[model samples]
Target: MTDNENLKTTPLDSLHRELGGKMVPFAGYAMPVQYPAGILKEHAQTRTQAGLFDVSHMGQARLTGADPATAFETLVPGDIAGLGAGRMRYTMFTNEAGGILDDLMATNMGDHLFLVVNAACKEADFAHIESGLGDRARLEILTDRALLALQGPAAATVLARFAFAAATMPFMSAAEMDIGGISCLVTRSGYTGEDGYEISIPAAEAEKIARLLLAEVEVAPVGLGARDSLRLEAGLCLYGSDIDTQTTPVEAGLTWAIGKRRREEGGFPGADVIIGQIRGGVSRKRVGILPEGRAPARAHTEITDADGSVIGEVTSGGFGPTIERPIAMGYVAVGSSLPGTRVNLVVRGKALPGAVVRMPFVEQRYYRG
Candidate 1:
């Protein structure tokens, strides 16, 4: 176990303690796993109202240079050059073997492309970006900023109270705005599968802005535990678990993230292998698994066929509070990947009944408008 003394703290660390949050080490940062409200209530709060998340641990950086987008396109599969100013796209950094290094959000910030990378992989990801782009793009790691997520059905309504422009921002759009007198870069996107905004604020002002948002009636402080459950129910991929150095985007069910132009042109790393997988198909693919019983199938739980042949293992799983059932996701053979395909989840030497199902066990309520 990681020692708490060695862990880093977010700008909202003191505030989390004041709210009785149980701080746990996550990606080297001391993040709140749950508050006095607990994970269940936090989950419900975000689903029904707004949950403020201190996601300051996430890595924020900027890529700037002449034709940075086109230069960046050489590293990832996404259509970076086509990303209009203020628009963001979900993408991944793939290795030469066509496996994901890290999943990230890239936004064309007009002058430079802003990137938000997974905290655990941020160091290596930035290094990879710097090595790949060389002089073509200048990487500026934003150490002075902190990120906060305001998520749920009432996110827009709550955020609008501070930044009126947030109410009208379309999904996947970003803008520089002032919220309650603090400058921030706000993006209408989140991992929770809800209409929300991710605000990038100066580290010095994060706690103040967080307090301002939490003071509202509809907003509450949410910890990481609920955030994980929320994203799991949304069927979103967790970087290291659901995808890794060996999982290709095609096999991970993220082929759509690879732009059509990149597919046809074939310039990015491992383009040959990924494009081939696109046309010829892969041996195994990621799929949603619904266990029949209330007992949740957890990570590394063996998935088997009727005859008890091991097919795959669950990568992410747990009780989904919103759906009020045990939900999971993992990779299985193509033959067993379809929805409604009966399977078994081996837990503690017992084979539990399950079935392959389509993802987003709960509908994603992203504010597309």
Candidate 2:
């Protein structure tokens, strides 16, 4: 029972409570914030060993049409038609002005396009997809499905037992497989910048598969608290927090997500403005920050120059378990975005020394076959 007005529960809500998880509101879901082992240990465990995350609160859907590629292409700028079946792409739904509506992952499942979108923005994403594609594309929200993420160095080895094909899956590849007799869609991708898999399965079968995964020695249940710090350490953006309608892909350091072809032959919404920013360069760019001391600079903290003149603001910030330091990400004037540049973070009205550093705070160990 969620007391928070905006909170919803995932299929594994009861299971989390049973595991001594600290439940909290995140993206409208009453999800596990952390377990008894705590955030620091959970975050470190995921980096060195393995951690299981209940991401059932995410939105999963199927896009069907006689020409799914054409239907889907209109919604996002990614080269959907060129995507091979059983492959995944990171793309964004852009507004008319070229601002990001939401960042999403789409997998080509041969017959239909499978999509996993942010839970907080799913309603708007679905509505955009439906209204834009109309009868050309049929959007089927997979309400009966639950998603899970197993991340870290040992994730592949543990998952290989059930989904043998996953052991060979390179980054961004996906496949249809059976795990413990349950049909599922498995992708070699994660937000933690670690080698992992995102598994989508029937909601009814989630508890069973989750229990089975947890039984593995290296796989521990990680909660939202660890998830946030992990992604932050990985230098990944949180939609509404790190990025929004006010931020463009170029401004957010996501220029790579924009296709080369799309850059030249603009067609998607906001193409003109995006192309302009790409060519001329954005005034402010997202950069990583390494604080001098232990105090973690949090979101909304002011970033200033040596003279204490405010330049930008922190979007995501936390103490990195793997890096063992305070790290943050925020936009700064282009001239000051270079690595090794001296800056200061204004926290609790004190000017804390910080330096622009290369991200991710920790190296990513993705299995790039």
The sequence of per-residue lDDT tens digits that candidate 2 reaches over residues 274-366 is 889999999998999998999999999999999888899999998988888899999999989999999999999999999999888888889
Tens digits of lDDT, candidate 1, 186-245: 999998988999999999999999999999999999999999999999999999999999
Candidate 1 Cα errors over 4 Å, as ranges: none
- Give the whole-model CA lDDT for all candidates, comma-separated: 0.95, 0.91
Q: How far is candidate 1 from the true structure (C-alpha RMSD, Å)?
A: 0.8
TM-score of 1: 0.99
lDDT value, residue 44 of candidate 2 = 85
Error of 2 at 90 (Å): 0.6
Best lDDT among the predictions, by candidate number: 1
